[model samples]
Structure formats: structure tokens, C-alpha cells
Target: MFVDSRRREGAAAFRHIFHVQMDGATSDRESPLMKYNYVALILGVLLILLVVLGNILVCVSVLTERSLQTATNYFIISMSAADLLLALLVLPLFAYSEFLGGKWTLGMTLCDALMTMDVMLCTASIFNLCAISVDRCIAVLVPLKYNQNQFSSRQLGLIAATWVLSLGVASPVIFGMNQVADRDLSTCKLEDDRFVVYSSVCSFFVPCPIMLLLYFWMFWGLRRRRSRTPLKDPCHRRSFCSTLVLALCHAKSLTDSVSDGEARTQRREGQRNRPKTVMRSRKASRVSRRERKAMKVLPVVVGAFLACWTPFFVVHVTKVFCGWCTVSPTLISVVTWLGYVNSAVNPVIYTAFNTAFRNVFHKILSRWM
Candidate 1:
């Protein structure tokens, strides 16, 4: 009986040691894991703040500046508004999901709602950019037809159509067409191939090609106009040539006689003093310095959008088509956040390229100072 009691006590001590060891191991595992979570949380917070603040500044700058109230800028304002909605409604939820290790705790209904808003806002932003390219093309190619009275209605119609089309693409999920099943509760994704194709075409494929084509057309038109117009500095060269020709005439007349020299000098002086009429081409005058800067800056905006969003869409479409293919969660998260970075970039592009926007932004900042 004594031996059995001793054995029981030894067993209790072993179990106690095992528990202590496990506790230490668990803590060792959690320390780095907790650090990672903290880092991710901080990054998410900063990203949200950046997107929200940048887009808000853009919207405010547009609203406060009367010079920026053109039809094209109205589309820009709409794009900023859409991005602002994305930052507010979609990004916070995404950040929370990231914090929770990709587990969406926001339930099924809110999940659907969030996903719908995500697709709608992103698609609308793309359409607005495409519209901006088209509007700029019109303004460059046909300034007379791009007057405010004519273009305002067209721009308004385009903006309305953009939102309507975005809604149409995103509404299928809301109506239970493409939904997350209970078994796949861990994932919040659009599993329907049809929905994926439709949304991809509407959001990326169609608009991207249109934007590219319009920009190419704009560049071509600008290039052609530039080539046709003579360089502006030719006036100086022409003046030098005229002076040389007059000197040659005076030298020739000097050899002839004093009478001939005096006559030629008088004629040349009269020709030089006569009013010089300079005629500038309509196309050269039409594209102002500001418009040229915009033309140069817009391609950078489109390129940035393509760079940030293309990987995400490519992987997304691949996942939709190839069910057997495995994409790491980390890759997905990185690509998605890259796409979100585009929202933060838009306002930076505007402020950098646009003088009026920069001035307004500076004024707005000065108020705080």
C-alpha cells in the first residue's frame, strides 16, 4: 500500500511538470505571433488613415476650388468619393479580418454587404478613370465641342451610368446568386465563375482597354499636332535671318554707288519697321500648358492603377477558373492591400501634377497653421 501511494505521488508530480512545460511552450509560440499581430494592426491603422485622409483632402480641394470645377474634375471628384467610401466602409472591415487571421467575424449578411460594396466601389472608381481619359481625349481632340454646356450633360450621364453598371455587377451577390455557403464560412469570396467573369470584364477588362485606347489616341493626336506646328523659337531665328539679309543688301548696294546704298538702306529700314503680324495655329493655342501637364500626368495615374490592381485580378480570375490551384493566403492579402494602395496614390498624383489643386491644398493646410 505504501508503494502504491508513492507511485501516485510520482505520477502527480510528472503531470504537474508536463503542464508547466506546455504552458512555457505555448507562451513561446504566442510571443512572436502576438508581435506579428501588433505590427499588422499598426499597419492596418496607418493604411486606413492614409486612404481616408488623402481622399478627403482631394474631395475638399475639389469642392473648395472654383477653378477645379470643370466637368473632367467632376469625374475626379466622383472617383475620390468612391475611393473614400471604399476606405470607410470596406477597408476597416478588411483590416479587422486581417487582424483576426483572415477569419471574418462579421457574420454572413455583413460579409455579403461588404463584398458587394467592395466590388461596386472599386468598379465605379475604374469607370470614373476611364471616363476621365475619354473626357480628356475629347478636350484635346475637339475643344470647341468640349464646352461646358455640351460636356456637362455627357459627364453627368456617364457618372450615372458608371454607378448603375457597378450596381448591376454587384447586385447578383446580394440576391443570393453568388454566396458563401455555410461549409465555406471561413472564406468570403465570389465562387461563381459567371459572376467572376462578368465583374472582371466590367471592372477591369473593358474599362482598362478603353482607357488605354483613348490615351493612345490622345497621344497620337498631340504628337501629330506637335509635329505639324513649327517650333515657337523660330521667331528669333527669323529675325536673325532678316537682319543678315538686310546687311547683305547694304554691302551689295555699297559696291554699286552711294545713291544705290541710300535707296536700299531706306527700303530695308522701312521693311524692318513695318508691323510684323504673327499668326499662331489654333491647335497650338488650344492645348494650354496646364492641359499639357495633365496629359503627361494622367498616364502615370493609369499606370499606377494597373500596377497595383493587375496582380490581384489575375490571381482572382485564376482562382475562379482553376479550382485545384492553390494560392497562399499571404499572397492574396498582399495583392489586395496593394490594390488598396491605389486609393492613397490618386490624391498624391493630383496634388503633384495639378497647380490649382496644390494651391488649394496649401491654402487648406495654411488655415491649420
Candidate 2:
């Protein structure tokens, strides 16, 4: 009995010591892990803040400002809504995962919903841009028909279609397609490889080419039209000059008659100003030159979009199709967030390129100040 008691006491002390060492090790491990992810946590929070604030500015500017209430701005508003929804619904969860060092502690159902909203909203953003490109193309080519200032039924239909199509693309995940048997619930991503291909093709591959082609056609038509008619930004000023000349001509007939030399000089001056007269007449008929200015800014927007998202889709597809090729989770996370960075970028692009948006942003921001 005495020997047995001694043995039991020794074993209990050893077990206690072992557990204490383990506790110490775990604390040490957790501290470094926490420190390692602190950068991600800080950056993610800033990104979320930027996206939320910037997109909100866009929404408010378009909604409140009458000048911004054009058809193209309506498309911009729709796109802003998508980005805003993405920042609100999707960025937080994904960012929290990054804070946890990319561990998805949020279970399957929430994760699937995240995936759904993420895919749908991002796709909608791209589609709206595509719609913008198409609208601009039509406006440039067939300027008379496209009401640059008003949203027609066709414009509303196009915006609605983008959202609906995005929903269609993302609906599969919501329908339990992400709930595959024997899959790890801790990992939150699309389950089916085929679905990856489908989403990539629909979201990036399909729209990108179409958008590029439309952009080409738009610029082509614009260049040809510009070459033929030569629309100038100083057209309004030209119209005023033309009006001034007409007024002088009308007023001159009542004045004392000029010498033959002076008469010839006046005739030459009127001939030089004749083109200005034509410009004055065409003032009401010229294409919306604001659309041309918009086209100049669009290449920057499209280039940024492509730069951010191209790597993501390329890596996304390669990981699926080339199973032998190894991609790190870190690389995947980097590219994914890089794509999310686009939501924050667009408002900056608009503010930089557009005077109307810039003025409104300044006005709105001044009130807050």
C-alpha cells in the first residue's frame, strides 16, 4: 500500500509539471502568432474603412447632386452600391479571418454566405463597368439616340440585368453546393473545381474581352467622328464669339459706309469668323463632349481593374486546372485582398478624373469638417 501511494504521488506531480510546460509553450506560441498577424489586422481595418468611406461618398454624390444624376452616373451609382455591399458584407468576415492568421473560425454556413455575397457583388461591379462601356460606346457611335442625360428603360434594364446575372452566378453556393461531404469546415472557399472555372469565366474572362472590344469600338468611332467633325471643348466660347460677330455685322449696316479698303478688310474678317458661325449653329446639335472626357478617364479605371483582378483569376484558375502546380495560401490571400482593394480605388479614380465628383466630394467633406 505504501509503495503504491508513492508511485501515484510521483505520477501526479510529473503530470502536473508536463501540463505546466505545455501551457507555457502554448502561451509563447500564441504571442508570436498574434504579433505576426497584427500587421494584417491593421491593414485590413484601414482597407475596410477606405472602401466603406469612399463608396459612401460616391453614392451620396450621385444621389444628392443634380449634375451627377445622368445616365452614366446612374451606372456609377449601381457600381458603387455593389462595392459598398462588398465592403459591408464581405470584407469584414474575410478581414477577421486574416486577423486570425487566415484561419476561418466562422463555420460553414456564414462562410458560404460570405462567398456568395463576395462573388455576386464583385461580379456585379464588373458587369456594371461593362454596361458603362457599352453605354458609352453607343453614345459615342450613335449619339443622337443615346440620351446621355437621362436613364431610359433600356438603361434601367441593363443595370437590373447585371445584378440578376451576378446573383445567378453566385446562387449555387447558397444552394448548398459548398457543403460537400468529407470537406473541412474550417476552410471557407468554393468546393467544386468546376464551379471555380465557371465563376472565373463568367466573372472575369467573359466580360473582360467584351469590355475591351467595346472600348476599342468606342475609341474607334470617337476618333473617326472627331476627325470628321472636330468637336472642341471651347465650343461654347466659340459660339459666344460667333454671336458677337453676328451682332457687330447687324449693327454695322446702320453705321456710316466704310471705304473700299476697310470694306475688304471687314469681309476678310467675316470670312475668318464664318467657321465660328457654323460652330454656334451646331452648339445644340454637337455630341455630349462630357462623354469624351469620361472615355479618357475610363482607361485608367479599366487598367486598374485589370491589374488588381488579373492575377487573382489567373492564380485562381491555375490552382484548379494545374493540380500539380503548388500555390501557397499566402499567395492566394494576397491576390484575393488585392482584388478587394479595387473597391477602394474607384472613388479615388472618379474624384481624380471628374470635376463634378471632385466638387461634390469637397462640398460634402467640408460639411463634415
Candidate 3:
């Protein structure tokens, strides 16, 4: 029975491959399509360039910025490293294939290696993202107990684990007995439909859902904790610990006081008498409380991951799970490059959202500029 089942599975895979080859040949022979190829080539090149420069900024900012170079930031560095590898290893093939109207000139070994890297890096990025989210949930929920020194070692262990797991799922492409098959257009790819489906599920589908769940849970936990514990800072006289919220609230009260247009004098007096202690204390304690607040920076890192990776994950799910899927060669090329765009986006997200990262990034740019 097992042998029969295997035989049936093999036959189905062969059919899938046969269809793919036929589709490639039909697409190739039907038209010149040079204009479409040119557009695709331009877009792919842009994505590659963006990914390279953006990731570099992120790495430089994290390393050079003393404030951001924490244990949690170490995980960020690992994530960035994975993104860099993705761009380096995967984007060129995607660009070339799309530019030549889905033609593949690279040999069989390269095809296998490229696919492996594509799957491995993307999986690793998502895995690291989930890890970052979990780390933040712990840090935010238990700020007092979350020490960087203690967490750093564990974060490194998690980063290592992500790579191992990613490589494990991607192993079949590199080492499985199934050999790369040539398409009608001479492009080589994994010919085993079962393995392809399995890898896609393992790499994209399974990991993404889990990451989404974790992110939702983390946000809910954060909201709950935030509501339960009123912001308390002995040094600040404001009702809220959030400085921006307090500022906005203070501004609104002033606006209300002035709405009469007759209380202009009173409004000026009120502003004069408004306590300066909160502002002074906020500034004064900022430097002193750096260490105290640094442990809570995990949220910033996780936020970066969420922003950079979410679109790619969403688009991928649409491609893999949708019914009657028939992606154009150009569209596939675009989405593949878009995935690489996530790699470049991670560093940009970090630098843009994190204050410490921004400062560090500015400093690095200044040195070069």
C-alpha cells in the first residue's frame, strides 16, 4: 500500500511539472513581450538596490549607536543579517528570470541552491520576527524581571535555533533525492510537486499563522497590562506616564480655555502658572533612567519586524492558498522581488521607528556624508 501511495504521489508531481513546463513553453513562444520584460527588469533592479542600501543603514545604525547596541538589538542584527543574505542570494535570479520573460539560464545546482536560500532566508526572517515578538511580550509584561544581561544569552540561543529550524525545512531542496528538472524553456526547478507543496506549507503557511497569533496575543497582553497599571512615575507630576499623550491633553485643555475668545488673558495666566516641574523632571530623568527604560525597548524591535514583514507575508498567503491560482510570470517576478523588499525594509523600519536607531543612523550617515 505504501509503495502504491508513493507511486501515485510521484505521478501527480510529474503531472504538475509537466503542466508547468507546458505553460512556460506556451508563454515563451507566443509573443516577443520585450516591453513587459524591460518594465519587470527595471522594477526588480530597484527593489534590489533599495534592499541593499536600506539594510546597510540598519546594520550600521545598530552597531554604531551605543544606545541601540543591546542584547535585544543583537537579535535585530541577526534578522538584518538574514535579510542581507536573502537579497544577496535570491534577488538576482528573480530579476534575471523576470527580465528574460521567465527564462532560466542558471544550471541545476544553482537552481536548487537558489530555491534553498529563498526558502531558508524567508523562513528565518519570520522565525526571528516571532521570536522578537515573544521577547517583547515578556519584557513588557515583566519589566522588572527582564534584565538585558540575562536575556542576551537566551536571545542568541533563539537566533541560532531559528536558523537551524529554517535550514531543516529547506534541507530537502539541497539534499533530498529528487533531482532538479528542466522546464520547457530550459529553467531548472524542483520537479517534485509533493515536496514543493510540503515545503511551501512548512516555510510560508505554517510559520506565518503562528507569527500572526503571537503578534495578536502580544498586543492584547500589552493593552491589558497598560490598562491595569496606571502610568506611575514619581518624578513626573502628569497623570499619564506617556509624554506625548500628556502633551496633547495639556494642549487640548488650553484650547478649551481659549474657545471663549474672551479668556485670552486668563489663558495666558494659566499657561504662566502651569507647573513646569513635569517638563523639567521628564528631561532631567531621561538620561538617568536610560538603563531603567532600556529593558523595555523590545517593543520597538518587534514593531519594526511587524511593519517590514507583514505585507510580504500577506501577499505570499494569497499566492499559496488561493484557488484557481495562475500567476503571470511578470507578477510572480514582482512578488518575488517584493519579498526581497521585506529584507531591505527591516533596517529601514528599525531606523525610522526607534529613536535610538535614528540617532545612530544619522551619526553614521554624517560620518560618510
Candidate 4:
């Protein structure tokens, strides 16, 4: 009886251990969080690929194309470089952070460093755009004063200053102001919501509003001196040019018809010798009309800048006020990716308004291929 009882006890213990192992396996196999993380990983990788390719193309085209090597082009190159840095440094880590499904695995120090880079590089790009706007505004307002030679050194100095100031502002956040993984939950980021808010405010809020005000003033000044100013809306400039070309063609046809009629009448009166002189005089008048139709596209670009960046500002404001408004991880990812996508669109915007850039791009591409 004792032996039988011991055998039953051993068999029951073995059965319990087998059941526990099955349960552990089931838990490991069916985790929803793991599935979601896999999705985030795939999506993040795709977006990073797009950003890398697009920014690299912009940089390469600017460097290779002679027409794009101007001071303005250099600023554009700076902007593109910043964007590429963000994609390389910030986006991949962000994706990995998400892969942990909001759980940070890379500890705190690295996280703080990445957060600092994101803030600093992003600020540098914003200030760069603002500088471009100011330079373009100045160029349009005082064409003779903005000699490319004189403007180049000043622009270079300002670009350097932009980098120095960005680093200065961002250093505190990375150095010790921010919590490290060694101290807190082993994750790096702008842990203080208040600090994030302040940083964004100082970087985007203050500078962006000032930029808008300056742009508005520039537009007003342009309008006030309308008679002396050439066309500045790059988009409008193209439309105006096309219209002028058609109008000139129509006028030339009309003048030719009138001249032919006059010559016919003169021939009937035995004086058919003045058509060449009359046609030459009309051609000179047409040439003068064409020369008066040059247009500048800086204002159009200002409008585009406002449109592209306004949504981000609005989203930031909504987040500030509605602190409890839970945004989906997916939506956050989309908005953040869209913000990065801005770098991709800028070259296209320049091509749309600036004929010289377009022609240069075409020549470089053709030659390379």
C-alpha cells in the first residue's frame, strides 16, 4: 500500500510540471504587444528609407549642378544635411524605441544624446529656412545692395552662428539637465514634458512667428512699391511669362496684318518701299515690351513655407492645451514622419518657381546619365 501511494504522488508531480511548461509556451506564442511592435518596425524602416533617398538626391543634385552652388543653394544644402542627419540619428532609434513598444531598451545616456541631436538639428534647419527667407526678402527689396559676393560671407557667418546657437541651446538638455537611463527607467528622451514644451516653444514658436511677421512686412513693402518691383511670386512669374509670350505673338500678327494692308495701299499708289522700316520699328517695340516682364518668386516660396509648417504648429498647440488628449502611436508616427518629409519637398518647390534651378538640374541629370 505504501509503494502504491508513493508511485501515485510521483506521477502527479510529473503531470503538474508538464502542464506548467505548456502554459508558458502558450503565453510566449500569443503576445499582442509583440505583434504591434513588429508592425511598427516595418513601417518605421520604410519611412527611413524614403527620407534617406530623398535627402541624398537633394544634396547630390545641389553639389553637382553649377547653378545650385550659389549662397542660397548652400543654405539649401545645409537644410538637406540636417534632415539627413535626423533620419540617420533620430528616426532609427525612434523606430527601435517603438519596437520595444514604448519600452526603452537602449538605456538613458544614449537616449538623451539622440534627443539632443533631434532638437539641435531640427532647430538648425528651422533657423536656416528663416535665414533663407530673410536673405531672399532682402535680395528682393534691395537688389543692388545684395551683391552675391558680399552676401556670401555674411550668409556663411550666419550659418555658422545658427549651428553654434543650436548647440548651445541643446547642450544643457543632453549634458545633465535631462534624466539618464542610469538614474531613471533606463530610457532616454526629453523626460520632462515641461522642458520639451519649452524647447519647442523657443525653437519653433518664437522663431516661426517672427519669420511670419517679417514675411508679411516684406509682402506689404513689395506691394507699396509695386511700380518699381518686378514679379516676385515665382509661380506667378511663370504664368506671367507665358501670358506675355502669347500676347506678343498676337500683337505681332496684328501689326503684320496692318503693315501688309498699308503696303498694299502704298503699292496701289506707286509707293511700295516702306514695309521694311515699318516692320523693324514694330519689332523693336515688341522687344521692349518683353524685357519689361521679368518676375521674382520669393513671395511664392514664403507662402509655401507657411502652408507646409502650419499644421505642425497647430498639432503642437493642440497637444499643449489638451494634455489629456490621447494621440495614437500610429498618428504620432505619421505626423513625425510627415515633418521629416518636408525636406524632400523643398527641392521640388524651388524647381517649381526657379527656372535656373530647373534648367541646371535637367542638364546635370542628362550629363550624368
By TM-score, the best candidate is 2
Which should have the higher TM-score, number 1 or number 3?
1
Name the candidate that leads on lDDT.
2
* lDDT tens per residue, model 2, 119-193: 999999899999999888878777766753458988899999999999999999999888788787767888888
The predicted structure with the larger TM-score, 3 or 4, is 4
lDDT over C-alpha atoms for residue 299 of model 2: 84
State the displacement of the C-alpha of residue 316, model 2, in Å, after optimal TM-score superposition. 0.7
Q: Model 4: per-residue lDDT, tens digit, 1-369?
A: 999999999999999999999998887887745555887689778867766766676688778776566666677787778878888998889888777776677867787788799888878878887887676566546644564254377788878877887887688777777863445564445666566677777678788877777667666655555554346633224443454444445445554557867544544433223333334433433332322221245445445555655566556556667979976656655666566566556666666777766676676667779
Q: What is residue 3's positional error in candidate 2, in angstroms?
A: 11
RMSD in angstroms, all models? 8.0, 6.1, 16.4, 10.6
What candidate 1 gets wrong by more than 4 Å, as runs, is 1-36, 148-151, 180-182, 230-284, 287-290
lDDT of 3 by residue, 1-369 (tens): 999999999999999999999999988877666424887679777877777777778777767666666666777777878877877788888778767777777776788788788878878877887677666556654554554244466677888999999999888888853473444436644566566667667766676667667656766755674465436754454532454454445655766546646455544544454435555545434422443354345445545455555554555455566757775545554555555666666666566556777777777888899
User: What is the RMSD of candidate 4?
Assistant: 10.6
The predicted structure with the larger TM-score, 1 or 2, is 2
Error of 4 at 153 (Å): 2.2
lDDT of 4 at 289: 34
TM-score of 4: 0.69
**Better candidate number, 1 or 4, judged by TM-score:** 1
Question: In model 3, how large is the Cα lDDT of residue 66?
Answer: 69
Candidate 3 positional error at 209, Å? 2.9
Task: Kindly indicate the candidate among 2 and 3 with the higher lDDT.
Answer: 2
